[model samples]
Target chain A: MEKLNKDVWVFVEQRDGKPADVSFELLSKGRKLAKNLNGNLKSVVIGHDVLALAEETFRFGAVEAIVVDHKELGHYRTMPYSRIINQLIEKEKPRVMLFGATIIGRDLAPRVASYTKSGLTADCTDLQVSDVQYLRKDYKDLLLQIRPAFGGNIIATIISPDVQTQMATVREGVMRMEPLEKHVKGKIRNIEYTPDPVDELVKLIEQHRQENKVNLKAAPIIVAGGYGMRTKANFELIRELADLLGGEVAGTRAAVDAGFINHDRQVGQTGVTVRPKLYIACAISGAIQHRAGMQEANKIIAINSDPEAPIFGVAHYGIVGDAIEIIPRFINVFKQKLR
Target chain B: MQRCVQTGALNQSIILRIKKAAMGFNSIVMVKQVPDTANISGQVMKEDGTVNRAKLPAIFNHEDRVAIELALQIKDKFGGKVTAITMGPPRASDILRECLYMGADEAYLISDRKFAGADTLATSYVLSEAIKKIGGYDFVFAGRQAIDGDTAQVGPQTAEKLHIPQITYSEEILGIKDGSVQIKRKIDGGFEVLESKLPLLVTVIKDAVSPRPFKARRVMAYKNARTLLELEKLTEGNSLLYIDQLKDDYVNKGLYIHTLTMDDLKLDESRCGVHGSPTKVHKVESVVLAGGSHEMIEPTKEGISRLIDQLLEDHILG
Candidate 1:
């Protein structure tokens, strides 16, 4: 049997030249996974003129940077991107590869996985390396992909024990993005792009990507609502409270589904995870999936009519009352106290 | 790249048909009957961590239903046949009928016990083989992800197995012209328009289009549509009916939802199910959240005032 390469690789997804924040997060996570496997952490940066982006990976704890530069790869075209990554993986045989579960990552990962004939899991919230025994066979140092399945009711630990290269597309913000205290001068191995005619089959007609209007991940305070807000009118109270506190307004997936909030403003497992300084949960019966995203906040205040609501579990302060009424009182109290 | 090598010969025919705007495209849609995860209740997760699917009502996956709507809309605009296929137990024919009601011309059920415990890899293998066996398809459509597993890999994986290009998270069909189809797909913050040649796959998101309501006439016509296994069950309970005769009648009348087993697709036994899967479930844990001590606040004015004062002192707020 060919020995499995222990190197951990993070696909440093980039748009234009700037790299995605999730790529840095994966580098931070890949650092830990590399340490566990006693291997080097490498960043696979692909784009036109993304050498600086490749260098940036070292600041995020990568030991080496593999750069693939080409004009056709300036933007993320699925065909070219997947082919480049597939070629690298096939040659390197890295033990574990990670990609952010962003739109581009989701599109490219599976195609690459299938083309390489490797195992891939999607939207994983947590990843770890451990030995596993499956079907009366023992496997060493497998990537345990932990994710909430069946609408976040249960968590399943999935492992690709039989495959040489295990891959996963992790949800953004689930892993913390931490730069090293001192940036390491990592080795850069530049690779050539061998263009194929198939890359031209799908033509990029037009692209319109605006900066996200809601920067919930960077907000210091978040006021989030849930389905219990009753109507879209009542849900506006959450926005009022967030405004009074100079914070961002967010909501649960159910609230988003109910049309009280937009999907972009959603904060949960299926949505973006947030670690605001304070999270004010209004009428949210915190499902485990919801908490997986926001429970890490420094201080949490939950307001719900039901005292037994699960949101109170992680709340520093819990108020058992109707949010429609109590939120108005909260707004009034803040106004009077600030005055 | 091997798939791309054949694109040269394929492109010649595709280009030759560019002028025929009225000619419709042949489309195949992949659909699934998933457990209603949105309304989960009452011991749905067994002690062993496997889902007690019996407790949850099975329904057509919303995104997949949307994919069917898109496919039907394509067929309506361009003239073509729409076929829907699913791989599940015999009971999964329920969703296939729903597909027929929603305007699919034909439906197929690929079911067998040997396919049990299949992960995404094995599942995609079976589906790809089924699609190939059906053949003559210009487009393959699937939902972005299913509600049950939330793994969106099957569509793209199947596309890869079929050796075709795939455009995922599609929101709208921009246009189909000059031997290529244009699509508007969702990205992180906005959208992108991409154009790909015919004989590709598209995975749709929920916001793509609202699934059309089942037509009254179509429902009346296809409500009794049954797969072979269903017909066998009916005949087993009745002494008067002959299985072969009933099947022939159903097929003749176009009421027989086509059925395929592993043997029918000629799939490698090892690759049809769990044995061919590379990934395995190491552990399943029902989420149990432990609540620690917390301070309860009064709903009165004084309570609200004190909470504000505490926030000011803690510097969490000014």
Candidate 2:
């Protein structure tokens, strides 16, 4: 396995002919890594009728797009997907591989690593290229995999030294997507997938994707609550503010544990990561777990009764008052101004 | 003294015997003693960004306790034994004792000076080796993620090392029938039910079920349970405490916590600790949020209007 011939590969995940946001983010980041190592950036697209998505990878920054289109690949089934990926790695021998830390990726990456006898760092928050010296050995141009460990208490930087390929899965909303370059052309290579017998072991009977009216990812404004809300009924303030702003309501793990909001609305380490343009935190003390998810918001406004609350530390604007009283008045002013 | 019975009665007894024999499910629960991250202070973070674990008090991982409770529940439903295992320093025996108080039949501590400073990959390698040595287990249960590492990778990695299937983020065990188990797992929005065969690894979440309180009787009985290291310390400089006699007594009373070392497991020294971990700390910065000229808006109607005006001026609102 010669490292000189290998290129950087990003797994472009798509559903219903639309690429996931993280796929584009990976391509943007992969472009930098490939350039730093002086290698070609390739996008691997696998699904049914995803030719448009294969071509779309070029705009994000892929120098070449590899498509493995198959009818059985429409819905993500673990066995078939892992087998195909493992075979590709065995053949092309990529120097670096990236996947989104999504449900499908999380399930598939470990299996592929096991098949290829490689090391993988999961749910990474950051990736960089660096020269590493360990145990009296020099590893140049190594991909640094950075992630929060110990429940967000510390960060760990991982590298794969001995393996032919280095793999990592980046969490959503961590990396900013690079602006698309128009009129950029890239090579497209299509491959036919032949399924092995083991792929038939598991069958996808049905998939139920709940209709989410509050799209946190696409929401530009988010009014989030925390444990200070006290009760489920008190969440009405968050809902009212979000409704007024035409945004979505989110909560921390504490609020979810208290049943103030559904798990889907959780904005923290173990939940959905959101990077809204404006984040209004109502009586929410910012724990590191919650901050890791939303620290990238363009602007933050924290309102709390305690002036010393941690949320105020990260907020661009701090309001030291009770949310119960302030939110109502703020809503009235906004309504009048809009009128 | 054989008594003749009807054909239907004979068939019923045979079915019962077969069911009893086949349904016996033994479980091994992997637990860890982690530094309480919630109560971290300034000194908890070392200069190298690694945790100064000695500065923080250690506690049994909360989710691991739930894993033990689930294992015990499975044992209660089907007649089998439950063993708790952990890989840490000798003092980790404290968690093993807590596992006993929570109804574990036995406990083992995989401890050695060489096993220190292990990342998720090395830790899972050692744990998988210990599991393989322990042998006959229908299921291996673990927490979804340890609070300390919070990687949520060890359980799946250990399963991969052992060449077994894994179900993670498990919330409930529906049942076990015909050598297959049904599990309810938490997904993004809702939960899904999955069915897998025996010899599977399941990582449980905090929302699975509330762990049961320690039994008072069991606590009183296992309070003095000690590993070999602690026993050696007890006999050190104290002529009254003889090591062999104390060990025999503890073993007879079922209070001895089994301890294993690298030599016992025959593990490769190269793949045991920091040497095996590929992760290196390139840099760590302590993030201290400094409020940059934050304004304290008064809790008044005029103040609310001023805040709205400022937001609009800043283009935060329309």
Candidate 3:
């Protein structure tokens, strides 16, 4: 039997021609999984003038880069873009493909998986090799991927019973990005496919371009606010704290509800998932929904009034206080040290 | 930022004010009330380690209702209607009633035992099938993820099942133009704004739209909205019950559920239930860790050395 493409491939998600940080993060994890499985890490790029991006992918830890450049592919449309990925999967048949569980990953992964009839685990908080392979005598491409369950309080490891090319769409920060210091040896493999000729399943009715995320997921430090901040003006406190530490400020669903932060910055089950070196939860009660989004951070520092707030359950260190009072002092301490 | 996305024709009265006042848009919302997820613990799970759902309290999933709220906001501004739909056990009617109370003009519950244990794929099939039956919808909105399963599949999967485009992790519906909706997608680092046409589906984040309070008047009016089964319980005597009498009574009162079963959809039996599902639970292993007594390792090298030496003695060291 012919072995399907046994290489590891990753999707380099970009916005308005700018690449997302999770792409590098995915590559970092990809390097490990590939090496573990005796495969290679290949990153796929689909955008215009992405030759520079191809070079950058290597810096981000992509061992090999695949570029599919087209003017129609310049803007994101579900149909044309999904077709591009489906074609790529068919030609390359990478054994394991990773995508950032960002907006695009949320949309495109299912479409691609359904198109290819493969299994996909979405918004996975944990990823690792499964141990069941030791029981199998013949199977060679078995993978044991792990993820958080029970809304992130427990870890559940899973595997595809019998599917080729086991796929997982990972949360942005769930994996860490390797530093771009020593350039790793890699190659750029070019495969061309027509962007047109596919039946248009949907039409682009109108477009209002917005700025894209640069490093929100891979940010070294993150300052996240919750309903504790109360009003929209209060969220500025979180932003100021983040600015002092050269970090990005995120919000919980409640903070967004209070009109403190926009929906994009939300960090919870339904919001963007991130794993940073340090996660500071301010006044966040740590609802299972919110915690499911970011419990995977390497170190968690929770600041809340309720000593028993669920956020403390996952925090490496905790402070029982008000967001209004504690955040200002914390910022002062941060400024004194880092400034 | 909380723009409603919709597809399909609506009563022009809904759009007239939007065209005139330049406010509100058409929207469709998906809602589900799941057992409160926070209520599980040791033996709160059963002896078998399965969830004791009967003891679990239910709440309108905070996110899915917010998706409905966003849709309702679109209806408020763009001058349209909000239709709320839920698929779950028959008891899910509890949330459909809440949807009705929350200002959705019409509501539906698609309940069938055959739909049980549906992974995201099977659930999407049934939702898409129901959508086809309901007909005439612009945009479909679902919570970014469901609390019970948290697969985040049904929304995007349903869109795929319908062969419509979907934008997930939608933080905000920025605007709608030429029947297409533009949205700010919450990506890993920042936001990506993508535009796709009407009839698109979007899975909304929890705060995408804060839901409005249930209206007093609508709550009172639809309070008696009964399903066919409930109606049967009420009129057990009529027509013995008279089939005609029961039908007329249900029609007049508008208390009908338009109940659908596996047979009505012409579904294959092999693909409907446990047999239809491909995923199997080989075994569920629950590990309970007991917090043990603390053993202190002293600061001094000798004490620490003794601690490590003891660790090896106790077989605690690899």
Give per-residue lDDT, candidate 3, residue B132.
79
Cand. 2 Cα-lDDT: 0.82
Q: What TM-score does prediction 2 earn? A: 0.87
DockQ of each: 0.64, 0.31, 0.14
Candidate 2 stretches greater than 4 Å from native: A14-19, A45-59, A63-80, A90-92, A114-119, A132-138, A149-157, A160-163, A182-207, A305-310, A332-339, B1-23, B42-50, B240-245, B293-296
Full-model lDDT for every candidate: 0.90, 0.82, 0.70
Poorest lDDT segment (10 consecutive residues) of candidate 1 chain A: A13-22
lDDT of 1 by residue, B164-212 (tens): 8999999999898866999999988899999999789999999889999
For model 2 the local lDDT of residue A279 reads 95
Local lDDT at A97 for model 3: 81
Model 2, A228-306: lDDT tens digits are 9888888899999999998899999889978999877888766768888899999797876788788778888888998
What interface RMSD, in Å and to 1 decimal, does model 1 have?
1.6
Give the per-residue lDDT digits (tens) of candidate 3, residues A1-339: 886666888989887788877788888888878877778888899888787888788876677888888766776667777778888888768888888876677778777876665667776655654435433444464565655555344445566555566777876655777856877776777767574633354544445545545446668678898887777787888889888766788988777767888777888755777777767788898865677677777766677788767777777666667778767766554444433
Model 2 chain A worst lDDT window (10 residues): A201-210
lDDT of 3 by residue, B107-209 (tens): 7777778878665556666777878777667788889887766767678767777777887878887876667677876654445676676688888886576
Clashes of each: 0, 2, 20
TM-score of each: 0.95, 0.87, 0.73
